[model samples]
Target: MRKVIVNNIVSLDGCYADATGNPLALNMDAAFDQANLDSISAADVVLLGRDSFDGFSSYWPFIADAPEPDDPDAPEARALSEVNRAISRRYNAIPKVVVSDRGGVPSDNAWAQTTTVVPRGAAASWVADAKRNGDGDIVIFGSRRMWNGLLGDGLIDELHLMVSPTVLGDGVRLFGVPADLDRIECRRYDGSPNVQLRYRVLAPRSDRAS
Candidate 1:
């Protein structure tokens, strides 16, 4: 069975995006590392809510299309940028399912061939069925509303949270008010600027005895 992994880059203060709904503070530079690369590359499908779908569809496809500006003083940075470009290519190739309650269809854009738009109420069943028969992992990125719904349905199998070192005093928060005490199954800190956390959600608060 395939697993649904909710992967997010959150700030130290627990915000997923800045006050203006930008994810600029997420220093995802280190994610080019092997461990992180493997996690992202393993996804055969990506699940996204409207916000994330719009954001990613506008951004990730052409992220590596331009030439990198030369900076002789920053050789390491230049090399890392190339690595990131390659990673972006791999990511763009994965199939994506965008949950949009509004009637939307894949566009004629180059990247749209791999995308599918599903209505909100129908997405839950599609995701659950995918888990039962899909070939690889289904990754969900930065879709809070979709996350809440899936979590409530007990459809998410793992959460790969990438916590950045910086703090955002205020912004749009991810993982809003919890309905229960979710359990952490495992935790690992890469020897880098960010920490990755993995958690397993237990049953709802009312279902658990004190």
Candidate 2:
């Protein structure tokens, strides 16, 4: 069976989005490093909640064309530009399954394609079927509610969280509550701007006792 990975970037205080609901508070250079690209590229299928789907679909497609080499910011922006280009290409090419209650596929005017919509209630079944008959690992990014459901359903396999150094006093948390987990690994990249915590979700306490 394929493994389901929940990968997200959050602030040090454990907030995924800020007071204004913006999820872009982290330092870009630290957030989109080589390790981030590797994790994203490892998956063949990307899973997204409605908000995540909307956010990514609106952006990544134009990333490759952005960033002017001659611009002043270019000196400091070049490395990240290349990384975003690579990630954008991979993100745009991979098939996506969006879990949403709303209807209709968003218009495919750009690189967005091979998209499938699964209603909210059926997300677990969809994920299970995909895991049974799919290829490569399934990855979900920046989808809090979806992650909550998956966590409760015991469908998530690996959880990767990139915690930034800044602390937001108020915001939406990546995980509403602490969960019992077995640490697979913890990586702190250079500069220590962010740390990636990887954990394997263990069976529920009840299940472990049986």
Top lDDT prediction, candidate number:
2
Per-model TM-score, in order, reads 0.81, 0.88
TM-score of 2: 0.88
lDDT per residue as tens, model 2, 1-210: 899998888888888888888886765454545666777799989899988788788887777777566664755665547777888888878888889998757576353457888999899999989889988999888888887778877888998988778789998777754457999988877766777889999853433321
**Candidate 1, pairs of clashing residues:** none
**Most TM-score-accurate candidate:** 2
- Backbone Cα, N, C clashes tallied per candidate: 0, 0
Model 1 segments more than 4 A misplaced: 32-36, 72-80, 177-191, 206-210
Instruction: State each model's CA lDDT, in order.
Output: 0.72, 0.79
* Residues forming the 10-long window of minimal summed lDDT in candidate 1: 201-210
